[model samples]
Target: MADKSTNNIELKVLVDKESNKVIFIEPENDFVDVLFSFMTIPMGTIIRLARKHSDPVVIGCMNNLYASVENIDEQKFWIDICKDMLLHPCNAADHHCNLLKLKLDDAEPRRYFMCWYTSSCKFLSYDRNTSSPCHGGVMDREKSLRLDPSQVGNVFVKGEIRFTVTDDLQVIPPIASTNYVFTKLDVMDVDATEELTINIGTVEMLNLLMTSLVSKTPLTETLLKPKQEPKLSSSKIINQAIHIESQMFGDPMDGDEEGKISVKLVVSKSKKMVCYAEAGEDFVSLLFSFLTLPLGFILKNMKDGSLRGCISHLYKTIRDLDGQYMISNHHNEMILDPKLVPGFCYKNSLLGIEETSYYLVNNMLTTDRSLISTEPSQLKVIGKKDDSALGFLKGPAMFVVTDNLVVRPISRILELHILKDLNVPVTDIEDQIVHVGKKEALHLLLSSFLCDSVLTNTFVADLREPKQEQ
Candidate 1:
């Protein structure tokens, strides 16, 4: 017989440790349903609940009822038994028993334990002992019966919230918290629908409401709002001064502003003639192009046009035209003074001159002994001039012209040897005269001099048309 002082709920349940199933829950009640819900609760939460409610209580299951010991070791053993019965088993139906008893103090309400199970089942446990019954615990039986349809967990429903503007064009922003419940509707089975409810604030509500309202307004009305043009400071506005040069040839269609010249042009008018002049970009470009031409080619073209005379003739004319001319060539003829010439000149000395002449003759004989067919007798040194007014000319210079018309300077000693080879007498041989059979006289005519000048002035001009390699 149960103690009359204790309140008890008699439940017939089948428990199988192998299957972890509690079946045939007899006379099921709210407390029993809550307890069943905790069958799958985590072990850690159960351990925490056991620690919180350390008071000894009688728990009955599987035809067995035992007082839960408050001692740590006994409590651990009971917890392991509950865990094995609830979780580790394969099926509770296999180990079913008809009689189970849960006894409680009659002074305490049944809802106390029910609330404990309910709170322990949550992700965060609620303290049933410390909290008021109606405050944090499960709803009472009457309230649970009158539960709202929205409160039901396993129901399917859809709803929308709308904000409408009334007669007043002015709309007061919604201040109340709004909620949106997104649900997957099940047309075939309304009871199996899933829903997720989200609490929204005024901003989110206005954002959703404005989306539809904006679509009704004309787009042009929003676009027509006056936009302020950016104002640039005086410093930011760049003052660009663009100068354009006028062309020599004019395009009649172009405006005067486009053709205006930037460079200054000063044209003087004579008493008998008037000249029109324009010195612009085109004139400067033409001048630069002419300047890029080869100097020899330019001089040749000028001579051909009679704009410039022969260079030698010009030199002679300048010397004759200016009586005080200090410049003269080797032949005592006046020439244009060199703007810059070599600073050192060959020193004139009889011994020095004889040594240099001997060195030159020996070098020539050693290089080409065929210049003199026969050896010459030793010669005496003749009178030499140490005073020569010519700038680059050293006295006793002899010119030798080969058969190929190549003229070169030879020493007087070599000239004497050549004259002796020709069987000419030493007395008849002039120091400056170099007559040889293997050479021709290079005529010093004005036209020849002009040609020579042109050839000398002309730079390397291969001008051979490039032939592609086969």
Candidate 2:
């Protein structure tokens, strides 16, 4: 069984004496398990944890998006649980991460919920407070679940194996000699290098997760350097302008593949910046869906797999790592491309992500011992039949998405307040119609990862470019 009592993982880091840079880290399987777990974290979970810590790490415009969900009134959503889902998103690899030496994700253990009258109503829910559709009854009765120990043991990488992790977060076996490793890192003078041992607890793990998302050198920033002041919200970073020259990732939009929603971008005439967007439920839902995506899924969709931070390198390592080094085939495969947890995926999502088909062992779904069976029943979806539309917001409503991605219901007074806040005159602001297909959706995702002015950078910056004379 994996050691669940350990609080920290010890790591040996090599640092350059002159530049004070981390060369590489020699970590055991436990530490590697922590590294691999970064891929399994949902985007919303990352933002939530960042805000929880004393020194919060700003992850692009996610802070604004998360705040939008919080600031919006509970009555605006389809149900109360919709807001709960965004604020505390679930990780698909929760069970796998429970076996790690250090647990960074603090989400409550997965609980099983079913209708109060389970004998007659077969509906199941992850949230106990959800109102049942059958009888408007609360699905608060908890059911005991039995997990197979053998299936989840020995997490991530194999034990008794030595590995070398680069400062940029590349994992490789230590097949080469120490001198050869030094040569690869360009360490000519061994006297200039020093070794240090550090303990990685939950705090440091959270710091590493934040740093890895923004900085290229995570180990050096997380360990050697002092903590930087927290940039808690997007409002703090919205003053600066950034231009990201990146190739579009998805296929070109055809007539049939065009977007269902047409967002109106309000741009500044003089500054050439997007102030905000006037959109309906469909566009807001698209932005909200980003929180549900696993890190691996977003990285996989990017054809080139290049982002602002070292996450791309980590993804490549998962793809390149040999199967022999992993604990099990299932372990390696799941980490490479994780899916959204059940009930969280949108059916007509523009990004084209799907939730995994989850089923419970019906025989063990009951708490009573007498009801248990020697032979388990066939796997079932354990809930009311989903009609393919599992969304967070109600329809026919308008919302305002600011440059920083703060979302709120649209109002005439609010529009005037925003214009006054930006000192933007009505004459200076021009509206542009933009269609959000797969390609534009991918660009928005990329900008949200790297830029602070998400709406301006993703939609407005392109309009300023000179058109080619075809």
| Predicted model with the maximum lDDT | 2
User: What global local distance difference test value does model 2 have?
Assistant: 0.71
- Each candidate's root-mean-square deviation in Å? 57.8, 6.5
Candidate 2, position 92, lDDT: 77
lDDT of 1 by residue, 1-470 (tens): 22243333333322222432321122223212122112212222222232222231111010010111111122222223322222221111101101112211111111111233332221111122333233465422110111122312211111221211111111111232322111111123323332222222222222212121112211111112112211111111111110111122122323333322122211111211101112222222211111112112222222221111122122223234332211112111101221100111112210110110111122121111223356622211111111232212222333332111122343456545544554545444221111111001011111111221111111111211111211
- Clash pairs, candidate 1, are 18-89, 18-90, 19-89, 19-90, 19-91, 21-92
TM-score of each: 0.12, 0.80
Candidate 2 per-residue C-alpha lDDT over 272-319 given as tens digits, one digit per residue, 9 for 90 to 100:
878888998888878887887787777766544444467778888778
In terms of lDDT, the poorest run of 10 residues in model 2 is 240-249
List per-prediction Cα lDDT, in the order shown. Answer: 0.20, 0.71
lDDT of 2 at 323: 65
lDDT of residue 239 for candidate 2: 19
